[model samples]
Target: MAENYYQTLGVDRHASAEEIKKSYRKLARKYHPDVSKEADAEEKMQAINVAYDTLNNPEKKAEYDQMLDNPQGFAGFGQGAQGQGGFDGAHFYRQSTGGGEHADFSGFEDLFGRFGAGFGGSGSRRQQQSFQGEDQHAKIEVDLDVAYTGTTQQITLQIPTYNAHGEPEIQRKTLQVKIPKGMKEGQQIRLSGQGQAGINGGKAGDLYIEIQYKEDKRLYVEGADVYTTIDVSPWEAALGGQVEVNTPAGRLQINLPANAKNGQQLRLKGKGIPNSKEAGNLYLIINIVLPTAQNDQQKQAYQQLAQAFNAYNPRA
Candidate 1:
C-alpha cells in the first residue's frame, strides 16, 4: 500500500488546496536535490512531490480519498508510492481500464506534465519552463549623517548563481544604491533586478536592503526624529539667553528658556532629516553643568550664590 498521502505531506486529510500548495513549496525548497545535503534528500523530495501532485489535483485527490476509505478493495493500488518508487497514477489508470494493454494515457499526460515540471521527471524529460529568480535580503549600515542627508553607497553582495553544470556558486555583485534621506532604521531599500539571476531567461528577483545606523554616542535616532543632549552651564540654564549649539543639519543659536531645568526637551521643528516627505524634528535635552571654583574669588562668588539660594530646597 502507498504511504498515506496526507501523512506524506504532513497535512490533515481535509487540508485545503492552498495549505497543500504552501507545504509543497516549503518542502521543495528544503529537500531539493540541488540544495539539500542530506543523504536521502532525493528520495524524500520524490515522495514529497508525489504526495503534493496527488493531493493538489481535485480528481486525483478524490480518487485517493476513496482508496483511503476502502484500502482492502484497492489493496493492489499504490504499491510503490512510498520511497524511491513514486506514486504510480499511470498504473492506477491502467488498473481502472481492466489492465488492458490499449489503456489510454493521453488524459493523464497533462496531469503528469504539471507534476513533472516541478520535480525533474522520472520516465521522460519534459520541456523546461522559465522560473523567476528568488528574492534576496541584506543589511547596509549608514551613519546618522548619511541618514539625515541622502547619499549614494557602494555595496557588495555574494549572490547565488548556477554555473554551466547547474551547480550553485556564489558570485560577488557590487551595486551603487541611492539611499533616500529620512530613511529610518529597519526601512528597506529595494533594488530591482539585482537579486538572484532568473532561471531559463525569466525575470531576475529584487534585492531588499535593510538600513541600519552605526553606533554614535552623540545622537539617537527615532524614526525620522533625532535626539541629542545639550550641555548647558549652570548659569546658562538659570538665566535666559541665546546659546550656539551644534546640530546634525548645522549650527544654530537657540534661546534657552528662563529657569530651564535639567532633562528639559526642546523641539526644533524641520531641523531633523531632510527629505521630500515631511521633515523630522530634532529634540535637544538639557543637561546643567556646574563649574568648579578654581580660585578664592570664584569660591567667594559661589558661596554668595549658595547663600542667596539657601532657602530653596531642591529635594523638597
Candidate 2:
C-alpha cells in the first residue's frame, strides 16, 4: 500500500500549511536521527522526511491528494502510476526533475521552506510540447558586514527523488555561491540551470536565492541606509570636537558641533551599503555619557560648574 502522508505526519488531510509544519516539526524533534534513541530512528526519519516533502509543497500536496481521491486516475498519465509500484503523480514529477544518488541529511535545515512567487516551471508536460522545469527559491542569512564586504557561502537544499530501485528519497545538493558587495536585504541571486530538469529537452529553470541580514544589537539596516549608536562624553556633547568611532566599513573620526545635544543625529554620506549602483549613508545617534565624581577635586569642579548654571533650571 502507498504511504499515507497525512497519517505519516499525524495530521488531518485538511490540515493547513502551518498545522502540517507544526506537526512535522514536532515529529522531527522526536524522531530526528541525531537526537532520537529509537532503534529505527533512521528509517522513521526518512519516512517522515519523505512525507513532509510531499505534504509541505502545495503543488505536490495537491497532486498527492488527487491521487488519493482517485487511485486509478493517473494510470494512463505515466508508467509507474499506483498498483504496479504504488507510484503517483508526485512520483512522476520527481522523475521529471532528475534522478540522483541519495544524499545524506546529516544537518538538514530549512527555515523558510522553498517556495516561489511562480517564476516558471513544470508547465505543459503534455506528450507533444516540452515544459521548463520548476524554479526554486531559498532564503539565506548573513552578517551585516557581508553587505559591505561581500562573501561566498555554501548552501545545501533537500531535493526529493526516487532511487534506482524506485523508492522515494531526499537528495542533498550543495552549491558554492558568491555574494557580491553592496547586496541589500530581500535581494535575489540567480543560479542558472540549478533547478529541476526540463521535460523533452526543455531548458532547466533557475534557482533564486534571497538574501537576509542577521540581527545585530548595535546596527540596523533600512534599505540602503545604515544606522548605529555612538556614545559621546558629556563634554563632547556639550563642547563639540573630533572623535573616532567604529563602522561596518571601518572606523573614522567625525567633527561634533559645539553644544551638540544628546540624541542628536549626524549623517555620514556614502558610508552605508555599497550597492553597485549607489552607496548608502550612515547615521550616527549620539548618547551623552556622564562621569561620576569620586574625589574631592572632581566634586569641587562639579560644584563650580553647577554654580555657573545656578539660575538655569533645566526642567523650567
Candidate 3:
C-alpha cells in the first residue's frame, strides 16, 4: 500500500490549500538537495514535491480524499480488470472510462521533469526561466552620536556575484548608506536591489540592515529616550547649584535641588532623539560621590562634620 499523502506532508486531512503550500515550501527549503547534507535529502524532497503537487490541485485532492474514504474502491485502479477485488470491476471501470471529464496530468509532467534530473537525467532537462533571488540580512553597528545626528557611513559587504560562466562568487562591495536620525535599535533599513542577483531575468531580492547601538558606558537607550548617570559631589547635591554637563544634544547646565538624594532622576524634556512623530526625553540620574579624607586636616574636618550631624542618623 502507498503512504498517505496527508501523513507524508505532516498535515491534517482537512488542511487548507494555503496551509499545505506553506508546509511544502518550508519542507522543500529544508530538504533541497543543493543545501541539505542528509543522505536521503533527494528522496525526501521528491516525496514532499509529490505530496504538494497532489494536494495543491483541487481536483486531485478531491479524488485523493475519495480514495482515502473508500480504499476498497481504488484497490484495482492500477491493476488489470481481471483481479478478483472486493469492488465491482464493472462499476469501477465505467466510472474510470465513461466520464467526459478528462484527468489532469499536468502535475505529473512537472513532477517528473523537476525530480527526474536528480536521478541522472540532468543532461536532458531545460533551464528554469526565472527565479527570484534569496533575501540577505546583515547587522550594522552605529554609535549613539551617529544615531542622534544622522550621518553617512561607508560600508563594505561581501555580496554574491555571478561570473561570466554563471558561477557564484563572493565580491566585496562598498556602499555609502545614510543613517537616518532617530532610527531606533533593532529597526531595519531596507536597501532595494542590493541582495543576491536574480536568475534568468528575475528581479533581485532586498537587503535588510538591522541597526545596533554601540555600547556606551555613560549612555543607555530605551526606544527614543536616553538615560545617563551623572556623578555629583556630596556638597553639590546638598548645596543646590548649577552644574555644567555634557549631553547627547550638547553641553547644558542643570540645576540640582537642595538636599537632593542619590539616585534621583531629572528629566530634560525634548533633549533626546528628535523624531517628527514623537520626540524622546533625556533623563539625568544623580549619583552623589563622597570625598575621601586622605590627609590629616581633611580627616579632622570630616570628624568635625560627623560630630555636627551625629543627631541626624540616616537609618532613622
In order of TM-score, best first, we have: 1, 3, 2
TM-score, cand. 3 vs. native: 0.66
Please name the candidate that would achieve the greatest TM-score relative to the true structure.
Answer: 1
lDDT for each residue of candidate 3 in 47-139, tens digit (9 for 90 to 100):
777677668877667766786788687776554322344333233324433353453334445565765555334566543334345568888
Better of 1 and 3 by TM-score: 1
Model 3: lDDT to the true structure: 0.73
User: How do the residues 120-238 of candidate 1 rate in per-residue lDDT, one tens digit apiece?
Assistant: 45666544444456678999888878877789999898887654333568979999999987788899999999887765566878999999988778679887788988899988998
180-266: candidate 2 lDDT, tens digit per residue: 999999999999988755444557668889999998887899999999888888788878989999888688899988888877889
| Top candidate when judged by lDDT against the true structure | 1
Regions of model 1 farther than 4 Å from truth? 1-88, 91-108, 111-126, 158-172, 274-277, 295-297
Candidate 2 worst ten-residue window by lDDT: 111-120
Candidate 2 Cα errors over 4 Å, as ranges: 1-132, 157-169, 196-204, 292-301
Q: List the residue pairs that clash in candidate 3.
A: none
